[model samples]
Structure formats: structure tokens, C-alpha cells
Target: MINEIQHTAETKMQKSLDVLRDNLAKVRTGRAHTGLLDQVEVEYYGSMVSVSQVASITLLDARTIGVKPFESKMAAVIEKAIRNSNLGLNPAAMGDLIRVPMPMLTEERRKDLIKVVRGEVEDGRVVVRNVRRDANNDLKRLLKDKEISEDEARRGEEGIQKLTDKYIAEIDKMLATKEADLMAI
Candidate 1:
């Protein structure tokens, strides 16, 4: 029973880390990346769909992304979707492909992005801490039910706390690296 609780808590903590990594990928740095637009949804045939589903996106250069829709008619719709996105990119239509050029970030804009990244890191830390709290509660319940001895429960609690510290430290390191990348000229 003690092992089961520890395994479940570890899995939950790993999931929290995965969420943080995904959120970081969507945040733009100083260069162009296709993953930045992976979440963009475009209107297709009266329905909204992810851009990746309708087109093949590629990074053409350090500041440009090329999107080619599988169907010719979806070109206009794809361009419209990018234009309306919060990314502030303008798509230039060429035949059946759309080219988006990433603009250089000004000092003020970079600072704003850094703030957003920091918020995401803090949210991740909260998730990990919540998981730790839940695990601690479960350990106490096990002790109350006499399912585990007092010594075992204490050791389990210590293990959970150590895991929480390790994951939180990992998040901090990732945030520092991303901040440096954003601040780099």
C-alpha cells in the first residue's frame, strides 16, 4: 500500500513537469519555431481545426515559417487564421503556401514575455506542491487506518517531500534558461 501511494504521487509529479515543458514550448524566444503555431486553430469548412492538421508547417529561416495546406482552397483560410491570431504575424500568400515572418522582439516586448514565462513556472510549482500535499494527506490517512506503521508513514512523507523539492528545482532551472534565451540579443 505504501509503495502504491508513492508510485502514484511520483507519476502525478512527472505529469506536472510535462505540463510545464509543453507550456514553455509555446512561448516564443528570439528565433522562429514551428511549435509556436502548433496550437493555432484555423476555420476549415465551417469548423475550426488545428493548423497542423490542415497544413504542413516548416521553418524556412530564422525569422520565417512556411505553411502549405494540403488542399489549395484552404490557403485563404489559413492566412486569415494567422492574421487573427494573437501571435501578431502576417501571412503572405504565395500560390498555395503562406509565409509568416517572425518580427524581432523589442526590449519592452521581451520583458513582457519574460514575465509571462515566469508566471507559467510559478503555476507549475503550485501544481507540484498541490500533489505533495495530497500525498501527505494520503500518508496520514494510511496511518490512521493502521494500514502502515508510524515509521513507514514518516519515511514515505520524507520521500514525497524530497521528490517535490527536486521537481521544483528542475522547474526553476528551466525557467532560468528560457529567461536567458529571451534576454539574449
Candidate 2:
């Protein structure tokens, strides 16, 4: 039972790390990547769909993202969607391809992004700590119910703490990398 609790707690911690990774990916730097437009939605037929569904996104260069729509007519709609999205991108249509260039980040913008990254790191840490708390609570409950020995509960809590520390270290590493990316010219 103690092993089961540790395994579940570790799994939850890993998932929290993944969520932090996806959230960090959304915080773009000056460099261009296909993930930047992952959230842009366009009207396809009668339903709204992601830009990636109706168009193929590629990195044209370090600073430019190339989006090619499958159908020629969808170029206009895709361009409009990218423009209207809150990514602060400007997509210019040159024939069938839409060129979305990533603007250079100013000092103020970089600082703002750093602040956002810090907030995300803090949130990640909180989630990991919460998982630890839940696991410890479960351990206590098991001990009180006479299901797990006191020593087993103590060991389980220690294991959960170690997992929390490991995940928090990973989160801190991610923050450092992101901060460096943001600060880069």
C-alpha cells in the first residue's frame, strides 16, 4: 500500500512537470518555432479548428515561421486568424504561403516575459508541494487505520518529499533556460 501511494504521488508529480513544460513552450522567445501558432484557431467549413489542422506550419528561418495552407483559398482565413490571435504576430501573404515573422523582444518585453516565467515556475512548485501534501495525508490516514506501520508511513513521506524536490529542481532548471532565451538578443 505504501508503494502504491508513492507510485501515484510520483506519477502526479511527473504530470505537473509536463504541464509546466507545455506552459513554458507557449511563452515564446525571439526565435520562431511551430509551437507558437499551436493555439491559433481558424474557421474550417462550419467548425473552428487549429491552424495546424488546415495549414502546415514550418520554420522558414530562425525568426520567421512559414505557414502553408492545404487549400489555396484558405490562405486568407488562416492569415486573418493568425493576425487576430493574441500572439502579436503579423502574417503577410505572399501568394499561397503566409510568412509570420517573430519580432525582436525589447528589454521591457523580455523582463515582462521573465516575470511570467517566474509565475509559472511558482505555480509548478505549488502543484508539486500540493501533491506531496496529499500523499502525506494519505500516509497518515493509512497509519491511523492500522493498515500501514508508522515506519512505513514515515518512509513514504520521505519518498514523496524526495520526489517533490526532484520535480522542483527540474522546474527551476526550466526557468533558467527560459530566462536565458528571453534575455538573448
Candidate 3:
């Protein structure tokens, strides 16, 4: 039972880390990355679809993303989707291809992004801590029900704490890397 609780807690912590990773991927850093457009959805045949579905996104250079629509007619739609994606990007349709250049981050913008990153990091920490709290509560409940001994509950709580600390450190590391990327010129 204690092992089961630990396993569930560890799994939840890992999921929290993954959420932080996905969030960081969306925070662009004046560099061209295909993941930046991962959230863009384009209208296709009366249905909305991911931009990557109707087109191919590639890095044209360090600062430019090149998107080539599979169908020539989709070029205009793809351009419009990117322009309205709220990513502050402008896509120029060059025949069948749409070129999206990553704009340089101004100092104020970088600081703002840093603040966003910090908020994400705090949220990640909270998720991990919440998982730890749940696990601890479960341990206490088990002890109350005579399903676990006092020593067993103590051990389970310790294991949950360790998992929380490990994942929180991972989240902090991700935030540091993202901040570095944003601060880079």
C-alpha cells in the first residue's frame, strides 16, 4: 500500500514536470523553433486543424521559420492562421510557402517573458507540492484506518517529500534554461 502511494505520487510529479516543459516550449526566445507554432490551428474543410497538419514547418534560419503548405491553396489560410495566432508573428506568403520570421526580443519584452517564466515555475512548484500534500494525507488516512503503521506512514511521507523536491528542482532547472534563452540576443 505504501509502495502504491509512492508510485502514484511519483507519477503525478513527473506529469507536473511535463506540463512545465510544454509551457516553456511555447515561450519563444527570438529563435526559430517548430514547437512555437504547435498551438496554431488552421481551418481545413470546415474543421480546425493544427498548422503542422496542413503544412510543413521548418527552420529557414536561426531567426526564421519556413512553412510550406502541402496544397498550394492552403498558403493563404496558413498565413492568416499564423498572423492571428497571438504569437506576434507576421507570415509572408511566397507562392506556396509562408515565411515567418522570429522577431527580436526587446529588453522590456525579455523582462516580461522572464516574469511569465517565473510564474510558470511557481505554478509548477505548487503542483508538485500539492501532490506531496495529497500523498501525505493519504498516508495519514491509511494510518487512521489501521491499514499502515505509524512507522510506515512516516516512511511514505518521507518518500513523497523526496519526490516533490526532485521534481521541484527539475522545474527550477527548466525555468533557468528558458530564462537564459530569452536573455540571449
Per-residue CA lDDT of candidate 3, range 59-175, in tens? 999999999999999998889989999999998988787899988899999999999999988999999999999999999999999999999999899888888888988888898
lDDT of 2 by residue, 91-159 (tens): 999999999999999899999999999999999999999999999999999999999898888988898
Pairs with steric clashes in candidate 1: none
Arranged by lDDT, best first: 2, 3, 1
Tell me the TM-score of model 1.
Answer: 0.95
Give per-model CA RMSD. Answer: 1.2, 0.7, 0.9
* Collision count for each candidate, in order: 0, 0, 0
Give the Cα RMSD of candidate 3.
0.9
Give all candidates' CA lDDT scores. 0.91, 0.94, 0.92
Measure candidate 2: CA RMSD.
0.7
Summing lDDT over every window of 10 consecutive residues in candidate 2, give the lowest-scoring window: 151-160
TM-score-wise, the better of 1 and 2 is 2
| Higher-scoring candidate on lDDT, 1 or 3 | 3
Off by over 4 Å in 2: none
Global fold similarity of model 2 (TM-score): 0.98
User: Per-residue lDDT tens digits of candidate 1, residues 58-169?
Assistant: 9999889999999998888889888888887888999987999988889999999999999999999999999999999999999999999999999999999999999999
Q: Which 10 residues in a row give candidate 3 its minimum summed lDDT? A: 90-99
